[model samples]
Target chain A: MSAVERIPILKIGDVLLASIQVDLQDRDVLALQEDLAEKITATGAHGVVLDISAVDIVDSFIGRMFATIAATSRLFDAHTVVVGMRPAVAITLVELGLTLGEVRTALDLEKGLAILAELGERAPR
Target chain B: MTAAREDIPIAADEDVVRVRQIVRSFAQRAKLSLVDQTKLVTATSELARNTLTYGGGGAAVVELLGEGRRQGVRASFQDSGPGIPDTALALTDGWTSGRGMGLGLSGARRLVDEFDLDTEVGRGTTVTVVKWSR
Candidate 1:
């Protein structure tokens, strides 16, 4: 069996970036959620950008995981923005009636960081 | 193009990921477009999840095929658990019997060129889908 591949969450300034490039397993999903939550507390980040451009597919569980990450980050006073979703993934999400509730999305990482920056400015310090 | 067939076990979420990988490998071998590959892989993942979660475990068979000048891949899911009580309702958007968002059947059908479902209460369920290369 191949070794486990973990999604690395890198911090740039006050924003955390997590790029998903693998077809994640169940444990991997749980690991990401746990790791992101821990990183938020450890880094004191004010924003997070998850780049899923390499993620070609997402089911309800995966979609729910994304929403959970965003919701969890909000608890730490950090904003989360998802970026780089392919067109086909969008279509599947819509067809499944998954809105990714309250999780912001952008076309790419640059725009995602920009949105987070904008939100950070609007947030009451 | 009916060249190869593979049966993958689906007893857990890990198996679901495995199914997607199998789909991806076949899609690449068939020279499907990236978009098409993503669609089929997504569809197969959903189906595999349904088999593992709702069906109490099952298997998916990936097959490569050819008709005239058309080439494609087909994934068929089979399970020995309780069958769906209402397949039509199950296929509806946002309708789920368990915890899912009900995208397994409907969304999968949309992503592929052909889809077929077979189930018998107290017997089992089977779902088949095909995506032709464009």
Candidate 2:
């Protein structure tokens, strides 16, 4: 068994960037969901960029985790953007009939931050 | 060279993760492309989850195959639990008896090069799949 790993959540400006760099266990993902929600409230962040660029695959459980995070972030009025999904993962997600539940998607982390910025600018403060 | 076979237990969530990591190393050692590796690992993850959640825990057998110019990997998930009453319906997209998207079986079929399912009510169930190197 591997040691517990916590995905880091970095705050940049008003956007929170969370990059999933390791192959997360189910418990790690569940822990992350809880951690991210708390971070949003603690930091008062407005947007979240979840960069999964290094992720090679996503089962339905992980897919549901992303949706839950996005939905929870919405409760705090924080926009969530998923970034860097590989082509094969995308295809598999579609086959799984998981649209990621209305979570926004971008091609890369740069674009993800850009989208979050745009979302931040358009919303009324 | 013929590859060795391994049997991994899928008794819990951590076991499922363990299976994924083991299959990943196997895929890498088999020289499967990144895309193929991802697909195989993803499919194995889903099946392992099913074995744990629905099958009351089971075992996954991983095998590496090479015959002449053809080479690939095969994984079989076996469970001794209440079998699916309707295999066809279970294979249908968007159909699930439990709380899930029901993509575990059908979606896994799409990712692999070959798929075989064996089940008997009150007996057990086994799903065997193979991914040919591409």
Candidate 3:
């Protein structure tokens, strides 16, 4: 049996990068999501960049997890941005009525980095 | 082996690909439209995964329906695991029992034209969804 992998966290300058490499299946996604959120809060970074490019689909569980991360980041005074959402996954998210207004989204990692920089500039130290 | 006309029972461990193949085969035999075929297949895949996760494993029934002049496809997922205690709460968005995001049932309902769910505590649960081609 293959072992379940946890998400990886990287601290680069003021940006805390959280990368997810799992299949995001029905099982084991919630625990991974909660762990990522807690890690973001504990890091106390200026902003968070979540890279989900490897994930082909963003089901309701993952989507809700993104929302939770965004909400929790606000409490920690850090902004969260989601990066690398595939077109099909985006359409599915829209059809499912997931509100991603509060959480910023970028087309790629570079765009996400730009957003994180902008968010840091706006936030007071 | 000749494909049977009766319902096909699938194990819970099957992935989305197998579920899609089963749905497509049934829809093709029924001569359903490509659009309806895709929708039904996607919805069935979602529900099948839910059954395995929350119900601890279950079987899906794929049937070709013909009611006089109208022809359609109907698929039902039945599980012997713990039945949903609160149907309304289960249907609500973001209310997931296991690791799901709680959109399987609601999303399945939206994909099909006709959806029916019946469940009883300690008994089990059955979800039947139908899509017609005019």
Please identify model 2 stretches exceeding 4 Å from their true place. A1-4, A95-97, B1-3
- CA lDDT for candidate 3: 0.73
Model 1 scores a C-alpha lDDT of 0.87
- Interface Cα root-mean-square deviation for all models: 2.6, 2.2, 4.2
Error of 2 at B92 (Å): 1.6
Reference contacts recovered by each candidate, as fractions? Answer: 0.58, 0.54, 0.17
Q: Deviation in angstroms for B53 in model 1? A: 0.9
Candidate 2's DockQ is 0.57
Model 1 stretches with alpha carbons more than 4 Å out: A1-5, A91-97, B1-3
- Residue A62 of model 1 has an lDDT of 86
What would the per-residue lDDT of candidate 3 be over residues B50-99, giving only the tens digit for each residue? Answer: 77777777777777788888778788888887798999988776677666
Clashing pairs in 1: none
Kindly indicate the candidate among 2 and 3 with the higher TM-score: 2
* C-alpha lDDT of residue A122 in model 1: 94
TM-score of chain A of 3: 0.86
Q: In candidate 3, what are the lDDT values of residues A48-120, reduced to their tens digit? A: 8889887655655567678877887778788889999876567656666567748999999899999988878
DockQ of each: 0.56, 0.57, 0.17
Candidate order (DockQ): 2, 1, 3
Residue B62 of model 2 has an lDDT of 95
